[model samples]
Target chain A: MDIGYAFLMCSMLGILASIAFSIAYLMGSDTRKIVKKANFAISTFTLLSFFTLLYYFLVRDFSVRYVFLYSDTHLPLVYTISAVWAGREGSLLLWLLYISIFIVLSTRRLDKLDKVTAFANIIMCTVAAFFNFLLLTSSNPFVRLGFHPPEGYGLNPLLRTPEMAIHPPAIFLGYAGMTVPFAFAIAATYYREEWVKRARNYLLVAWAFLGFGILLGAWWAYKTLGWGGYWGWDPVENSSLLPWLTASALLHGVIVEERKRGMKLLNYALAVVTFDLVILATFITRSGIISSVHAFARNKEAYAYMVLIVLSLLLGLVVYIKRKDFFEYDHSYRLRERLIQGSVLIFALSTVTVLVGTLTPLLMHASVTRGFYRHIEIPLGTALVVLLGVCVIAYRESMLRKSVLHSLVAGTLAGIVCFVLTKLSLASLGVGIFVFSLVGVIQGYSSRKIDLRRAGAIAAHLGLILLFIGVMGSWMYESSYTNINMGVGQSVHAGDYTLKLNGFREVNGNAKFDVVAYVSVYRDGKLVGVMHPKLIIYNLMRSDRIVASVDIISLPLEDIYIAMGGVTPQGVASFEFYVVPLVSFVWIGSLLIIAGGILAALQRREEKARKGVVDAEGEG
Target chain B: MKKLSILVGVVVIVFGIALAMSFKSELCPYVTVSYVVSKGEVRNVQVNGTIVPNSTKILPNNTLMFNLSDGKTEMRVIYHGILSHYQEGIPAVVVGSYYDGVFHAKEVLLKCPSKYKVAEENYSTSKVLSKG
Candidate 1:
């Protein structure tokens, strides 16, 4: 424990040394190897201490209470080693170490960019040090209680799965990667206008991981959480989503500035705000702060740590802007009048609303401010159609170039399809819009060749519209519940189908008690399929939850999603009997959305490459 | 410009309709334990209380202990976390519609009166917490 504290203290001191060197260098001092060497020293000691902690767990060192309390004698070796990141404080320290290592790498002398990057690393390290300071004070995992612990409490059962590794790490990578865009933007802000190019790579890196991270989290929830749906609009989920949506807009917004020589200041502001929201998201998730399943939900220490980081960055950003004069080109009426322009403004406003919505809980907690303000993500819809709307203008002469009268006639036809599909449930508001989009697509396709990038963007938007309709259908219409103590071959009517629970079988694993209930789905006295919903009692949490593993009978029109999450007395498995209409559209739409992201990224890369070749007098 | 109006009109009209629909039946996850306790009715009934075994359970599972409290009366409770309650010492307001004899916890929300918040409110809540 003493060694652990000492090692952590050493790293904190290293951060100080780095900061000292940074201050000196900024004050125009030469020969700053002292701070660089100090950083390396700090990271090394921190790494060593971290390894010592890991090594102790692996060897089953009964003396260390963390090991005794968390690790079992029969635990697998992989879990034992990964056990380092399994606790509240341990994970904080691990992430801190990761940030430090990232700082060290980014700060190194890379031919020409190192000099400019030093400032960015200093900011990154400052953020990292706040975390280290928390570890050194409040929540040290290495604190000993003197008495020997017999066996370590295992990892939380929900967190012990293979998906756990991928989900949390991907989120961390995505969240942490946002700092890169932040760093380069700050650094470039202090330089000549030519340095804007330096920030593009950071933007791309942040965008890619943010996409992957959000996708991984969604996938994890779909597979493991036993929830019949994806994207529950949870506050923490919204926190991540806010930055992603804003950054997606900025990604396109920045390209306009990069290529068409417009929206430069807008791009810079978006970069800063996106990074700030990352801290806010961290605050929302870590601060026991809000009522979110994604968050740890009881840690005030996390909140304090995040607030300090946000304040420091805000101060640093101000210091940077005050130090340099960034050239701003006017957003002329021609550029400002465009649909994308209004779209970007609405996008930013929507981002602000999300930030406000997320922060509302923190405000309400103290009884400081209150009123009914929620549903931040909904405002993004304002600009959603705007993007697709521009595609018409951008590709007007393409294959779809029919007169306005054609859409009026075609839209009426498309509305009928939507109305019929929804079974007359009054949520037919999607009818008019879907019809218009359909006509737009068809007309554009029929008249001229659609630009792949432009066409893909429209298709993706059209798909999103489909997704919205699907989500509404599932959320409002779906109904399900649990079943307790039933006789052999007991039947229950759920929504539209009769389910006969045939039998229960007990299955044991290395760590969980599973009661699998086999149910036969029948309609009109015809046996259609058997769905097995498992009730798993995990050893780690020593609790029972239902994992309704239904043999999903998927159809083109409707999907029968049987979900189980808990066990009942008398060998009954608790399950949600649901038949969601157009459930498959959700996944299919998401894939199409991802395909759009890929195509968009490829489009940008090709554009950049061509620009690069052109700059070299078309030498490639 | 024609396309732009159509898109704007579509988004505004659709979202306007959604908001309008939502007002009739507010579907939200506000049915959390704490929210229920704050606004729901209090009734006397038996509940499965997994009174948390605090510092003692930090040891072994067999040496586990729990405290059963209804704010007025306290008792010893010992059952596995089958329908586990959150940590004890928390002034948890359990919310449920009681019938027969059981005060089944339809939801359990724990909100300990914040000593820190009180202090912060006396001075800092307006500045920091007000616009949080």
Candidate 2:
């Protein structure tokens, strides 16, 4: 009679209904009526299940085991809702809900192609069924407690930030978005070219979301984790990067298959790899086979995930073997084609390297350091930048000797300027190549008639150049770890600024306490605003958890970051200061990259519409 | 097109060599405290263990010294840097070398324990107490 039981019953009904619908679709039944109605019903029930869980958290219903574990009376309303996906069971439900909505939207779009839509629905529903089973068996959020507790244990102190509310959902959306493309890839194995075209827009949307999600995670780590650096090449982070890399390769490979009818098999394989990697990422974070900061507690759901992955791989292998000859293309290769091929190859190689590095710990029982990753990534990244420069010059045309010469000169000149500015040797060379690519793309865009598709590619390439420059400047030439102890009115010099401890204030919140430090900064004897860095301690069920807050003064060229250490018995506060150069450009470049991806998706939609009109005219 | 392929092949080979060389210099393989104790005073090696509770001390020069234990063996670690907020009895990884029976740590990374570990323990204990 409880809400939890009702929610569980609804979810169980959804699973059974979807399974029946999938069976009907796979049997070549006229699934038009069944598909539409079942998709609507399943999506509605999943939403209701999610909302029911949310209702429990909102009402402080500690009788439900999940609500008791993650929420308390003192927790804020926003985080109360966010805590719905903060743990294992609730996050799986969120994943199921997103996939159900995707199935409804995608099935609606492919209404004209009934057979292909039916096949795609079978694929989507099977995925949905797997998650539903996991939720039902191992990770059911609807489980209840016999005894009612007066107060609930609160959310993890580390996950109590504003970014925690957005980060998980963005990542889950990225993971769910890939399912549409995977379904189309399965359809492509049978229907080939037509399905590939249909899958392109979905692939772009997924790639864009994944990239945006990654940037948001990096921002969260940089701001909340109190680490001066953004990326640590953690196992969980690398798991997400694996899919993004393969998806990037697929994004380019599909273009080749679209224009030249080549790389068809590669595109299909990339799609499969992207989806498998998404599931693999989930497994890696949940299984606890590897140590990661983002992992949930070790659970039995890992076995379920592994079984799903193995079955998917076997199915993909069978399909690839059955239709081996369908991927053959007879067109002679061209320069532009070769450039695209090179980029895809580089992406594939990078993904392999990261995958090996990330899994090495589990296989060999030895962990590779972040330094090992940088060794492979930096040189490979620099070469990719150089290749992008060549590709921009060779866009829509064969490579010309004169253009090559021009690019070389531009690169060298830019490199020299960068060397003079930053005084770092190899990174200057990287900047030089980036600037050369930027110039080439700009020239190409301006010389041609306005084409949004090509413009989107150019914008993305430009964004990469900016991102490379920012990373090089910050990583190669930054001052850090300058610890200074100062009392009120005592000044310490760091980089080009003077930091003076002004005062401190204590903040007592409902669930936590904070000691906020007021530090004044001056540049060239000009006063800047006061920076408030805090040390926070949260009241949990058993003990208090401490977290440091970073205060950052961001500008176009650099950031002045300060983290409060603590106060000594002598009344001097300890602070760590870092002057990171050109880091803002990284965020700016990320925005540009996201914008370019969205622009490209819009252009694809327009192109598809135009093609539909032309086909109709020809039929007439 | 063949020439372009050849050009890419050459670039990949060159980058591969550079990557391999960089890997050699950047390799920081983690060793256990027992391994470090057996092989004394090795340079640029990492060790992973747990920080012994209440064994931490701050020196006059602002350096921190603590005992790092791996259940069976314990070693002293000296770190000279800004110490972040870290809990006692948690897992930690120290990046440095062993010298004169102590770990001269260049950096110390503290790992967060599973939040549910305590809850699980409490639940089991309460159940046992009720049965008794």
Candidate 3:
């Protein structure tokens, strides 16, 4: 066995030991010391194995089969590092690393631990061991090639971007981090009320990372896919959205459970479902059961993930069945609380819709189009925005008149803006609701003395509104001018902008040969920028593959997006230009949401410990 | 409370019906060129086929014209979009329909075959063919 394989074996052994010790601790044994040591050992061995694999990539060890498959001598240092997770086996290792790290973090402060924590530790250890088992059995990265080649097959040319390098790990971190909440949910069902408080931060971090990961994926798609749109409702994309929607709902539902001791069972169910969706996402992306642009491969490893999903759901159902009293709806909510419940309900329904759309292909051999999602989700999203506005306004005592007046004013202003920006359509009403909610958030924030959680909520709400506006403007008002064949120094009018093709040149680099076409974007007869859209030919073993790189100029109102289709032999170039409006808001809004999530996750320990007392005397 | 529950039930039923309708309307089957040819005049279908070698050319109107085959049947395809990942003999899923003896493709999806469980023998062969 090689060094990497040896390290992974040790890691697997440590995981198995930790599982045994944690279970023994759960079964009235004083193996706490052993459990902790085993946990630490698992972390250390996994880290060592991970680094050893990275070492293989860095040294360009073609003798290692994974390195031989994904890395080459000519790859940059950063990409060489990313090449560690560029394949199925290495990414599974990355998942193991995250699981080990989270396992240590979640079980760090436990002594005289309750049965719940012990149970949680056991579940977490078992999960880590399960993934390790997968690595050892099916998707091991340490297989040897027996003979070192002169060079290796390079990483996919599309995945050589900074965003692509970071996307998979961010997504895997989100997937791995979700186990803490799920384990806590199952453990808390064993008789504890502390899971809501304990699992909240883990849930928040996973939800935030998942959101940011989806954003990065969208951004990368817009940049590299040469398509004018970001989210294409691809099955894999829908899989990621499935967990995000449920987790978002669960995030809100836990607040209810923590505060009012209501929706406890629902919160547990959400946690379980979110975790299941994470596995489902993995299965869809890897199984090739349904075709997606991000297909990994159909493999036995995917079947293992599918079994894990079923077992997780079964475990959740058993716990839920055992704890029937937790399902009692004990408290009548206030108007604001009810609105939040409505919003959560909408999120849950949207999750169901997306799940059906995603799985329909596997069931019926027919895929649902983007129209299917938009037709249902847009109205649901609009209702959510309206509920958000009303929910914010309902925080005050005299809300009816103030809310009506505020919503009217925000709606009128947003209507006018939408009318001027694009054509006034039914979507303007949705934009108006977004603006209403945004204004309500601003007003509520300015009027009240708030804590970090409240401020973070407001920031996140504002960010969502901005993101909604961005989605509405970009998807609805987007226009493209394709088949714009131009010679050098030729200018053509494309909507509100003029695209002047200046020249073409070729450059041969060590990794890629680029044929870049320079085009000057002008608005109102003034030069905005010289954008160079390139046709990149990545130098690969035995062949070269040509891909188009998009050049975008982010104007104040619209982005001038250009991609060169091809350059003819006569020096004439064909181009596709897109005017995408308010696309920057998607990015800026995503950053705000992430920052808000992080801010909320980093709440003071005292604040988190402050539990909301249930007033039994209140009306039910 | 009972009346509210009834109202919610009605609203849910109505919404579910609408969702089912939209889903039915939006269902696009993934098929092959032979299936499309057999069906004849199929609409809103995704056809998977291999790009015929040396069959790709830019038409006079700047649209891309190529021949797509599924080993048995080959059909002409007219695509308006830019497909930077197109390679001869590589598998592609084209979303559109077959009508008037030609497939008018709205979108073409091509993913890297190296990532697949299936061996990339076709990809290597296409590379060799391109070189030749």
Candidate 4:
């Protein structure tokens, strides 16, 4: 028997045992110790199996089919590690490994095995078992080749970047972390009223990971795809966004549920839908049902994923319908509460639009144009930004007039500055909303006594405003100069920037050869720097594939992006140049959003500690 | 609160109707070359086909013209953008309108050939190396 296969089998058995034991505990058996042991056993077996697969990649074991497909003798150590998850089988193993890790974290403190914890553990174990069954049956990473080849195929040149190494892991972490809140919700339907509070923190952490993962993917596309655009709304991309949108809605809806114990159905449904969307995303990406650039080749795993989706949805609906009394609550909503609820509705609407657009090709046999998404998103996003400003400012009703006055002034000043810089007439509205949100955040800080949760919310809202501003600037007024043929030492002017092609050089690396163009960029006759846009020819298993590598000269306000379209042996090159403005704010704003989410999660812990201290004092 | 909820509901309803109208207008049917030809001229549609080998040409002013085939019928496609990954014998999905017997594509989406495939045995080992 293969060692990795044996380890995986043990892990699968361990999960089955854990699931059975958890069910036993839930059925009034004193099986806490047994369930904990089973959970720890599965985690160990899963860790061993994951490392075993990684070990095969590192050792260049061509006898293993997966290693033979995605690894090579000349592949670097870091990429060799990354190749462990580059394919369908390896990535599924990576996801299962994350599930096991989260399982250990959830079940480790089983001494106080309450009903909610027991139910959550059971749900987690059941999810783990499903993935384990997938690995053992259809998509096993440990299948041995009939014979060992001399050299293995290398990883795709596109995925040979640093970002790809972390992107899949971050996304899988987010996907797996969602199971916790989902488990909590399912358990809470029959059990605890305060489960939303605990589930909110987990959701925050997962939402932060999902958001950061998406931005990383977008950044990778901008830097590598050579399209000069960050987002294309591809089906695979929309699949990920679907879950993030639902998670965002759930995060907001939990605030209402945690405070007033109302909107329970909204919170529960969002949690369930978020988890189901994650599975749906996986199915869409892996099943090849959708024709996306990022989709895996058509496989049988999609059927299993569809089954999982239906089962989970049925489970969620059944559990939700059983608890009719949790939906009954009467509470008067404040203005701030109304604004937050409005934000949640906006997120839900966005999710629905993107979902419909993504599925239209499959269902209606029609492709939704980019115009469809932009038409919906622009107005919805702007309204959400405005609500963010109003929500923060509505903290004090007495200062509403003064806040409006300040916001108007700030917005006008920002609009004037933007007009002077870009000389564009249509940017005033976007800048006004951005500045209004900024003023609201500033006032939000000034009026509060340093509450971390509020501070985090303000930071997140400001980050979103900046991101919106970046999108507006880059998309609306982007300038492109295509098919500019230039020779050595020849200069061309493109929208206030001059590019002089210095020369082209060829260099041979370990596994690839590069044709690099050295072009000096100048603004107003002053030399800025030389940017090298290259064409990389990677020697793969049977052919040499040519890939264009774009070079970007990022200024504070804009990025001078260039791609060597086709360079001839005589040194004449056709280049594509683009001036993408305010794109840097997208990165900066996304990072701040992730940071704010994490800070909010941390604030929950601090608040819990303070409450615990107060309760202890009262007992004393 | 009730009044505000009603106002929000009205806004969402109006927005949804507008959105549905825009979506209906923007949706382009995914069709084939034979379908487009059988139906005469199409205003907007998406067609997936393989690029005929040696039929791709760079026209004047960098407009790309190619012959696209869906195994049954072939059609002419004209595009005005830079497709860095464009190659012969590769599958591509082009979004455009078919008129005057030519598919004027607004965008071209190329499918990378080396995504995920089983390594074929007895493969040609000859390297087709390009200078630049």
True contacts kept of each: 0.00, 0.27, 0.39, 0.39
TM-score of chain A of 2: 0.93
Better of 2 and 4 by DockQ: 4
- Give the clash count for model 1: 23
Angstrom error of the Cα, residue B61, model 4: value is 1.5
i-RMSD values for every candidate model: 16.7, 9.8, 6.8, 6.7
Q: Is the docking of candidate 2 incorrect, acceptable, medium or high quality?
A: incorrect
How well does candidate 3 score on lDDT at residue B19? 91
- Where does candidate 1 chain A have its weakest 10-residue lDDT segment? A365-374
- B65-110, model 2: which lDDT tens digit per residue? 9999888888999988666444468788888878898899987776
- How far does residue B105 in candidate 2 sit from its true spot (Å)? 1.8
lDDT (Cα, tens digit) per residue for candidate 4, span A222-293: 877676888988887889899999998888888777777778888888988999998888667655566643
Candidate 4: pairs in clash: none
Best by DockQ: 4
Candidate 4 segments whose C-alpha is farther than 4 A from its true place: A292-298, A420-423, A542-544, A608-620, B111-132
In order of appearance, the predictions have TM-scores of 0.73, 0.91, 0.92, 0.94
Q: What ranking emerges by DockQ with the best candidate at the front?
A: 4, 3, 2, 1
Candidate 3: residue A154 Cα off by (Å): 0.3
| Per-residue C-alpha lDDT of model 1 across residues A1-620, encoded as one tens digit per residue | 37877888888888888877777776677535765676687678778768878887887876776676556665678777666766656666766776676666556553432445667767777777877877887767677758765665655444445655555455555566667667766766665444346555455555556666676666555545554555655566667888887777777676577665676666766777777777666555545456533343455576575677568567646845675355456545343235456667667656655555555445543111111123434435523543443345444434234434566566566667767876663445455555555565455455555555555555566666566556556655555443322445788886567888787677767765565668888878888788776545545422212223344677785777666534433333345656767666766665566555556546656777889889899564
Task: Give the 10-residue window scoring lowest on summed lDDT in candidate 2 chain A.
Answer: A291-300
